[model samples]
Target: MDVLYFAWVRERIGLPKEKVESQAATVNDLVAELSAREDRYAAAFADLSALRVALDQELSDFDASLAGVREVAFFPPMTGG
Candidate 1:
């Protein structure tokens, strides 16, 4: 899957996007796997409540299924000016 990071998430993970190979069934599972990989990933996913997720560009939740998903993006919630 292609995992993308935006805003501060890219800053923390040090990459805007990367291909990931995993057996995760859900978004939260993927997060746990990444968080276990390094301190940077852990910091990037420190608070799920502070972040938002997208599956193939569609807004999704951490518990959302990853079936047939080709892309996943993580970013902070947007604010209106």
Candidate 2:
């Protein structure tokens, strides 16, 4: 799976995207795995409530299923100007 980081997430993780071989079946599981990897991922995912996620390019929730998914992106919730 390709995990993507946006804005401050990219800053925290030090990358915009990366390919991951994960056994995680859900978004939360993936997050847990990523967060456990290092401090960078932990910080990036610190406040899950403040984030918005996209699965396979479709906006979704943190608890969404990852079945047959090829991409997962994390970013802060967008605000209208």
Candidate 3:
């Protein structure tokens, strides 16, 4: 799956996108896997509450299944003025 990080998450993880090989079933499971990889990943995924996830460009919950999903994006909730 191609994982994309935006805004502060991109800053924390260093790169904006990467193709990740994961056995994770759900978004939360992926988060746990990433968080275990390094300090940067841990920091980027520190607080799930402050972040939002999108599966193939559609907003989704963290517990959502990743099956058949090609793209997973991690970013803070958007705000508009």
The most accurate candidate by lDDT is 1
Tell me the whole-model lDDT of each prediction, alpha carbons only. Answer: 0.98, 0.92, 0.97
lDDT of 3 by residue, 1-81 (tens): 999999999999999999999989999999999999999999989899999999999999999999999999999999869
lDDT of 2 by residue, 1-81 (tens): 999999888899999999999989899999999999999999989999988999988899888889999999999887779
**Which segments of model 3 are wrong by more than 4 Å?**
none
Model 3, position 11: C-alpha lDDT score: 92
Alpha-carbon runs more than 4 Å astray in model 2: none
Model 2: per-residue Cα lDDT at residue 1: 92
Lowest lDDT 10-mer window, candidate 2?
71-80
| Per-model TM-score on C-alpha atoms | 0.96, 0.94, 0.96
TM-score of candidate 3 relative to the true fold: 0.96
What global local distance difference test value does model 2 have?
0.92
Task: lDDT winner between 2 and 3, please give it.
Answer: 3
**Winner of 1 and 2 under lDDT:** 1
Clashing residue pairs, candidate 3?
none
lDDT of 3 at 69: 97
